[model samples]
Target: MTGPIEGWAGPASLGEGSVLTVVGAPHPVLARLGDPVDPTDPAVIRLAADLFATMAVSPGCVGLAAPQVGVSAQLFVVDVGAHPKTATLHGSFALCNATVVEASRWRPGREGCMSVPDLTGDVKRASRVVVTGQLPGSGQSVTITTDAFEARALQHEIDHCSGKLFLDRVSSAHAIYQRKVYL
Candidate 1:
């Protein structure tokens, strides 16, 4: 759908899927906070692969966190590429237990999640942000300072790590919009 890899409801592989299942809202796992993951662990490597793969297969998905895959670990994969709205693309990358260290400016943007695909919401987010975390499978610290769509994607993924969804941050109940389609 997004790029003719497959259909939106089916597993779309950008890399290795691990054939992972993406958990949806009200599934207890979606509300659980992630524990810090050891970047040097082999499991972490596999997680990164699975996350990227799952993200690729999903239409309009730009980011995914460990919890979305039912893993209680702080890690996420993001790629602003392949998105028409993104000009400052970061390609594809994964972070382990990333934290947003700085944020500035504010804007409300429409956001939809793989976990809650039936809805979209206008959530207020920082337009610029800095996030630091260990690189997947490497135990090396990495920090990224980005603006626009990249920052919004980071905030969305990080919120998943914190057990928050765009629905929770919607300005009001009326702010939520029904999403009849994706991508």
Candidate 2:
């Protein structure tokens, strides 16, 4: 289903997915830039599904990127519907070669990642953003304009696909914290 945001018809269906292992911090793949992929390729479709499945199985994970799963590809999955901070819900969707076209209203918010596992940071991100990406399977292009937590989640995942982590966005060591809970 399309989110409350206008014009997004939502993502095309990605077939069956299997949970893939999430690579932790310091993994070489996480530091390398992801390569662009053909959205309609069978392998790309499967990777989209697998990212979604892996996110689903991980507690408190709202997004996942191919690089986090040890693949250096420009792809990620996000679903922030259940988060209390989310004001715009896009449901679960995978985007290939996504790019941020516009961003504004910068603010710092607590962020974490399944790949990092042990740290959370206060990162400055746009509270409102416009992003464009191609959907897997159909290779359909979609533009999403969103705000609040969903926007933050999207930016976070996109950063992962670009080989950057939340830690990279923190202002200083004071902005980073050791995560005390994992569930």
Give per-residue lDDT, candidate 1, residue 2.
20
My TM-score estimates for the predictions, one after another, are: 0.88, 0.93
Give the CA lDDT, 0 to 100, for residue 103 in model 1: 97
Q: Mind giving the per-residue lDDT tens digits that candidate 2 earns over 1-183?
A: 245333333433676789999999999999888999999999999999898888888988999999999999999988898899988777878889999999999999999898888899999999999999988887888899889999999999999989999999999999999999636
Candidate 1 lDDT, tens digit per residue, 1-183? 122111111122223556578999987777878888887787887888899778778878899999999988898988877777675655677888899999999999999999998899999999989888877655678778788888899999999998888898998999998898535
Q: Which of the numbered candidates is closest to the native, going by highest lDDT?
A: 2
Off by over 4 Å in 1: 1-17
Score candidate 2 by lDDT.
Answer: 0.88
In model 2, which regions exceed 4 Å deviation? 1-12
Q: State each model's CA lDDT, in order.
A: 0.80, 0.88
